[model samples]
Target: MAADPGPTHPPQHPVLVVGGPTASGKSGLALALADRADGVVINADSMQVYADLRVITARPSPADEAAAPHALYGIVPASMRMSAARWRQRALAEIDAAHAAGRLPIVVGGTGLYLRSLMQGLSDIPDIPADVRQAAMDLQAAIGSPALHARLASIDPVTAARLHPTDSQRLIRAWEVMQATGRPISAWQADPPRDVPAHLSFTTLVVEPPRAVLYARCDRRFLAMLEQGAEQEVAALLGQKLDPALPAMKALGVPEIAALIEGRMDRATATATAQQLTRNYAKRQMTWFRNQMPAALRLDAMELASGTAFTKFYDRIMADMTKNITKMG
Candidate 1:
């Protein structure tokens, strides 16, 4: 009989990042891994950070959260926007706290920017003046995102070319930066990044299932959320009458459900529309993770969801973490 080997352990604690498209079972994987590794699950999803729309956002349920330590989920109000830099600050503190308690830090979510900020750091872009910010928003609302992109091309062609014409948020940001400072936003981005600490090493896993399977999961999950009081969640959020541009207000399913409540859309139409949007968002997430995270260990979503496969995967991850650790001493 072969001799049994002891549990694999790294010389130093390593942060595990579980990134994937929505409805990809990242939360379940993270929860199970947290329990096995004595880790803390930290939220990296931008939508999941908002306190409102918990049901609509498909945040981990209370029962699941009770099974292990979780942090940075549903902490920020929907009325406020969270920048990548701000989230990095909060997430780093959480990681430090988790390390101090002798637990692994598992950062889980599909937010590429958030994960990137943690691993690669962020550029030092100066804050845009309030008036300048408002002007950019007003212009975007007045002319629509595509038209605004054209206007941006006239001034900052380099930055404008990189952003999708329909990417209203980023388009507005680039325009705002150009207007606030004489230099383009790309110039600011080229400056050396700050605030990244050198002590931590990371093992990242990205779940990318077959597209057909992922789309079906996305559709099913949105419908499940509706049955689980997502409509009520959206209605309550709309009752606050927050700015439409707010990230939470624009979260998936919010607009469709809000239209349903307002009588502008029928129930079936709203459900179908939201499901399609969710699938589209999932596709974008898959593309971003596949193209950006070259070094991540890719797993099939179905495997991550399976009990036997997940156990084997966890062992592989432990080996990877131990092998990939960067010496700090």
Candidate 2:
């Protein structure tokens, strides 16, 4: 008999991460990879987690969902807020389930915070009292985020300096922590011994396309969304009368579309406004990915547009994974 050969690749599967700005085709890449690897597509986008405003949020269509196993998309109610800590917990569990099933876990999204929390672990901040939380929200609504940011700067200059003045959600959160715990959120973050998982290895693929291409895609996608009943989706979501501060209410197209529904803006104005916002958001996402994931493998968005490039990309990933496992052994 001929000499026996070793198994083709390593037995353990590394967790795969597909990350990029919105409309960069990361989702399509993820779907293709998942189909090939028998992997599960886990939601990492914060906006896509909401059960409401799916169309405006540009969540996976019914056909896309049916094409592969997906986890953690559209699971949270719009009325409640989801923290990165909560999302990390759920994501870790989903990853474990995928591994146990002998499938790759593809953590896919552009939410840098959620991905960071998953990799580095969250700060040890205690829960704020409901009254304290409500008070912070109320104060921001009354005085606006810039004003609240000024207040936070006095209490926690380090954290304040890091946040944008107009970022209402984080500004309110910082104030709530200070009021509830009498400690700066930044101080808690400096505490040692975080809860990072040691067992799993992660391989991240970041999609970076030319700015012109990405911006064009963002604009085109939003228009397609409008034609596909985004207006109705926004109307239904607004009908719920959820708090304006809720994350879902602030998703890329929701507020703009809500304005249209309420006669605050005409349809054309609303569409144009939403497209601009999406482009701005995509730019921010690109910046975040570039700054944060320095070690990730980068794929040009145009590269994934063709079938040949996708096959080549897949082979490159497999080759990299094999090299990593070989080094480990």
Candidate 3:
């Protein structure tokens, strides 16, 4: 007999993250990778976590879930606000469970904040007092996001410049943090507390499709959502009379569909408006992933959507994982 040969590759990391902009075929790639790795597919998309807006959010369908175990999709009621901290706790539990069961954990979504919280941990800003939060809310209600953002710019230009003028939630958060801690939120984020355990390693892949191609997909996907009962989904959610301020109520396409349902807009107008918003959102997401995950593997989503290309991509991922593990060892 020939001499015994050593193993060819190192041990694989326990966690794999697939992230990108919307309509970048992340879900499909995650599903395929989970199947190949005997992994559980976990949701990291903020919108997809709400139970009420499945159709509008483009959550994985039942047929897809039937093919592999999926965690964290549609698990939270729309009435409840699921923060990134809350999601990180749930995701950690799921990851541990998957590991104990000898399965890989494949977390997939387009939510950059959630992924960031998991990988780099969250900022250690002190919790804002309820009174302080209420005060910030009052200020925002009185002056609006742009005016409040201008105020924030005076106090914390770094955070203000990073947030969009219309991003009310983050603006208010920055304002509240400053009020409570006498420090800018950006100052706190300069140092993050480790959330994930030190033992775990992650292999992150970011899908980057061409901007024009991604925009086209976003438009077509939104239209498909409408065709696949998105209107009814929105109507049902609106009927629940949940607070209009709820995050789920603000999901992409929900407001447009609700407007159509209420006769405030025609279907064509609603669809066009929603498509434009979706494309803009995808553009922002692409920029964020590009800036934040500089070291992550970058794959063109257009290629990954094709069968042959996806096979090559998967093989590359496996090889890279082995190489990463070897280096770490």
What's the C-alpha lDDT at position 63 in model 3?
Answer: 97
For each candidate in the order shown, give its overall lDDT on alpha carbons. Answer: 0.88, 0.87, 0.87
Tell me the tens digit of each residue's lDDT in model 3 across 121-192: 888777679899888878887888899999999999999988878667778889999999999989988885
Q: TM-score of the candidate numbered 2?
A: 0.91
Q: Number of clashes in every candidate structure?
A: 0, 0, 0
Please provide TM-scores, in order, for all candidate models, with all chains considered together: 0.92, 0.91, 0.91
Residue 147, candidate 3: how far off, in angstroms?
A: 2.5
Best by TM-score: 1
TM-score of 1: 0.92
RMSD of each: 6.1, 5.0, 4.9
- Residue 157 of model 2, lDDT score: 100
Q: Give the least accurate 10-residue stretch of model 2, judged by summed lDDT.
A: 6-15
Clashing residue pairs found in predicted model 2: none
Please give the lDDT score at residue 189 for candidate 1: 78
TM-score of 3: 0.91
